[model samples]
Target: MHTSSTNNDQTTELDALLQILTTQVASLQASYRTSNTTERIPSLLKLKNLETLGPDSDPSLNETRRLIVSAATQLIHTVQSPIEIVQDYAGSTFKTVALGFVVDVNIPEVIRDLGGEKGMHVDDISVHVGIDTSYIARVLRYLATRHVFKELTPNVFAHNRISILLCKRRSFEEIKADPISRFDDAPFAAHVHMFSDEILIETLSAFSEFLKQKDLSSESVKDGNPEDTSASGPQSSAGLGPRTAFNLKFNTSKSFWEWIAQPGAKYEDLARTVAVVMRGGDKMVDEGQLVNAITTAASGTPIDSSTTDITNLLPLVVDVGGSSGSATFTIKNKVLQDVSGIKYVVQDLERPIDSARKFWAENDPRAIETRQVELLVHDFFTSQPPSCQNASIYILRMIIHDWADGEAKKILKRLREAAYPPLPLSTQAVSPEPKTGPRSKLIVFDTLARYTCDDPRENLNRSGKEGSTSVPWPLLGNLGVAGEGFSTMMDLGTMVALDGKERTRDDFEQLGKETGWKLESVKPGKLAAFIFSAF
Candidate 1:
């Protein structure tokens, strides 16, 4: 009787999940119909045009997607045996390794050139990549099973929608001609390679052992010698200590940035990958939403034709540590295109500032020629230069997540001091009050971490703000594995690589309060904008 009852309960839960899946599918179909597209699942042959759909681009579609993925994943968990599930996860590393191997060997480009959609046999692919036919078949089969590539026939593979994205657009010959610069035009491919390559994979491998050690604190980790503490064994870069899993794996005392700066083909390739990845940060938030966030924080309202003149109110925007000025360029082109008298500055280390000069020279030479945009070399750890002290807005995109809480606070404090500079002691008797001007705004564009379980505090904190999504019952609050997967993965990746983290709403609030700023509002999207005002 107890066994029968247990089976019945399991059936009931499965039924609930199926119902959720069915409902979400219907919603997705309705969205497709509204956009005048076929109400069928997107084709595997090509990328979907959901982004171009007018009204169908609403948050409802994303919500439905979240529900469908969550329900389906939960159903799989319900039916799959524990041992099977564990094995599937245990072998997951092979997926990354296989994907990386194919990408490194330029399999996607070769397949595209040799056999478009028709597919290529393992023998042909093996000849092109110089790998064993059987090995190529197995690796392709593994990826095909995961829906990364497609298996059209026995020992034959082709580029599916997912795999086709890895194409660098250059011909196979061209890529081979310039092997080192192959990823220069393919940022997405670079991003995948960075994660799956030896550096990140080896770093992640040390995570388990690294966590096992006592005193994983920053101080302890920084102080301990890698030679003495590394359980894996000693490394070539001896004398240096382990600050993170990356440090432990590589046996370097230098930070991720410092280590990457050293001269080497591998390090240079990794550096280029990181720079390319960072260039895509602006795409994380919608342009309109980002513009509104910055303008609203600058003035008391959003930008419009009849909006109050911001020339005298807020004259300049300083992008602190804004590598290559991509975000600054987005702002200049989108919001300040016609707003004359207002200036823009892109601040970074000397190397990035030099890159910024080249970037601006190509994109908008007039801005630099007219002195509308200035590239400045500055470090966030040091005091803000006198020129940037009175700037109206300071933008930090994907910057804060690169450091731990303590280091992150120092960066914030430096910006806070710049935004609200203390009154001069010599003029205390004459003008003692704080400088009278528009309250300087600090726009931190980064990921906002979400909890897997429902948290009432988030609901209260984001009461009237955007970026909050409702989770239906019977699913994890953050939509289980469907939603927040990338963010959580990034959280761990940052921790492994640089001892950094993604922050929750409470974390941002506390950081703001501690750094003499007030968290005014949050504009959430792929990368949430945390707008803070100097107190």
Candidate 2:
């Protein structure tokens, strides 16, 4: 009787979820049609070519799509066998291996060259990639079953919407001519390669062993906070050098950055790939949104450049650890093109500073010639130079997630000291505030990690003030696979690679408080802008 009751309850829950899915699907269809000049939703097998009219282009459409995906995922879980789900999870590593294999061998490019939709036989593909015919067929077949590529026939494969994204957009001949620079133009492909190739794959393979063997050595324990002695999780040991799964696998004491910075063709290739991935991250948040975030954080109110003299109010914007000043240039060109006299400084290591000089020289020589922009070869771990101290704004784009809490604190502390330098011992008692001058703002642009369960703490925090799109009933608060997958994956990747983490809002607030900064506000998006003011 109890078994029957439980089954009936599950059936009722599935029916409710199905209804929600139907409603969401209808809403999505309507949104698509309205946004795309009354065009109908395309077939599943058809190639997607909607540029500005893509699902992500419209907010309502994206929200509806998330709902549908979440409902469908939950529905699948409801009916799918436990063993099947476990098997799928266990076999996912091969999926990554297969993806990395095809990308490395340039299968996507080969298929594109031959015939896009018409399809190519495995025998032909084998000739192009220099792999065994049967092996290529099996790999392609496996990927096809997962909808990565299309299987037009038993042993024939073709590029689909998903597979086409991995293309280098260069001719097969061009790729062959310069295989080293093939990924130079293909950020998405490079992204896949970086994640699936030996660097991450091999590092991740040591995760289980690394977890099982606890490092209770003095090196690990000394660097960590004495009060926070939690043995269940990984701890950061910046002073001791890299000690994560990456360190275990690579058998190196240097951090991932230091290791990658080593002089070698292989490291150079990996560095270039990293740069491409970072460049691709620009699409996460719009430049206009970033400008608004900066203005609000700097002035305590959003200033309209047309109405206010933004140049006079905010004299300098320091790009901390900014590689080649791409984000800075985006803000300058898009929003502050006409706002002259506002100095922009791009700070990084020697290599990136040199890259910045070259980039600016080719793009806008006047900015460099007139001294409006300065490229400084400075490390964030060190103190901010006298010239750049107490700037109106310091932008740290995608910087914080690269370090564990200990190192991240050091970086933030350096910025804090520069933003509000300590007063003399005699005057310190009279004035609690660090300085009489205008306070400098720190804007950290990074991923705002989300949780699957609905945490009320997030609702009460400043970072959570900007409410997310309402998830439908029965769907996870974060929309499960549809919404939080990338962020969670990134969290794990950072853990294995750098002993870093994608932090939640409370975590950010606590980190800020520890380093003598107060979290003032948050501008949420694909990459959130956590605005802080030195206290």
Candidate 3:
């Protein structure tokens, strides 16, 4: 009994010692952790503070600690997500800039307003643009988030440096004084109707139907016999596959150019709207420095020679698919002014020519008398004429995205053929040593399919619709799928009216490659965003 008791005591003592050692080690570990955590608290807090404060806060270190604290407080704000607030502010500003397009509804007047470095304010802007105050303010608010305007308080806005390139500045009075021709104000904005409207919906719906049918088009076969290759062929027949069936059933009598050329059409609204948007900041050639920038960017060559005589060097310039000749008008005024033998050819359709002629005749008799530009009715999908062969340049301004791959290829092929015509029988052997160089370049000015530079402010203006103040979320989402300015209302009209659709940059390039044209480079600007050069 004594031995057992002694053993029990010893076991109890050993357990107590083990517990004490464990307690000491745990205490040491906790102390170390607490010390380490205390050391890092300030750093973690400092990192958490950066989310606060305005993006343009002073960088001076005099009040660095105070600034950090302030930033933390602002960063922790729960009223609105910082991103949301910024986006809203940007949207407000973008709306303001974009609404200008809708308000002015007059291209020349808009350009005239933007001729100088200092742009007009909302109130003064309203007077020039003929838009109401309340609506303009709302639009400006949305544009603000996008940084389209520096809201120097409510009802006032100062244009940004980059905003000055949206449009080519022009004298409204001069445009008014000149003949109101079709080319003078072709409905440029209205062209976006196809992508925004019924055509896209219909196309996608058809695609969905195709997918449902195991990747087969849902149209009925034309012939009763299974052996009839016409059922599977790429030919058009009534009640056939989607491509062929739609080709025949959905046949449009009037081409897009023809439809827009209709006398007294609503293109006037589009013209005036684009004019206002352009003039908002896109000052015309009046700013010689801006012109030089554009010239350098467009030409992709150094302008080193002081007396290169830019005008005389350009002989025959073809404005391919130059709707209403807005780009041509700007370029001619800016670059080709001194070139004596310069002749501008604006190609579209007989319909565009008729209105363009009327517009030219009514507006600028001297311009017409000088014969600076000749309107040519031509489809870009067909063969390019000899007159345009090896021309000094062919400028396709905002034209390439109007069709799908197949149609775009046809257009590109036409241009490519023009650049490199078939060797004649007589000159086949002596074909100028095979040229051994890239020539007859193609200039394209248009929007990218779904890409844009990060300017929360400018994006709103570029994508917003006329009359509405709210930023378009749906349109933004659909930019990659459809386009930025898409409208179902416009698509139905296009199908019944214009027979055209918008395309993406990828679509354009893919089509270009199929047509033996190589994409050389792309110059992205503020207004249209991208200019593609093809060889």
The TM-score values for the models, in the order shown, are 0.85, 0.87, 0.43
Candidate 1 segments exceeding 4 Å error = 1-12, 34-40, 47-60, 213-241, 301-314, 338-340, 421-437, 460-469
Residue ranges of candidate 2 with Cα displaced over 4 Å: 1-11, 37-39, 49-56, 213-240, 301-314, 337-340, 421-438, 460-465
Cα-based lDDT at residue 339, candidate 1: 63
- Model 2 has a clash total of 0
lDDT of 1 at 93: 87
What lDDT tens digits, residue by residue, belong to model 1 across residues 402-422? 776666776787787777444
Report, for every candidate in turn, its global Cα lDDT versus the true structure: 0.73, 0.74, 0.43
* Angstrom error at residue 447, model 2: 0.6
Ranking by lDDT: 2, 1, 3
lDDT of candidate 1 at residue 273, scale 0 to 100: 78
Give the higher-TM-score candidate: 1 or 2.
Answer: 2
Q: Name the best candidate (by lDDT).
A: 2
Candidate 2 lDDT over residue span 387-502, tens digit each:
78767778898888877777677778778777744423442233323333346678999988877766666642222236543444566767777877788889989888887789
Candidate 1: what lDDT?
0.73
TM-score of model 2 (CA atoms) = 0.87
What's the ranking of the predictions by TM-score, best on top?
A: 2, 1, 3
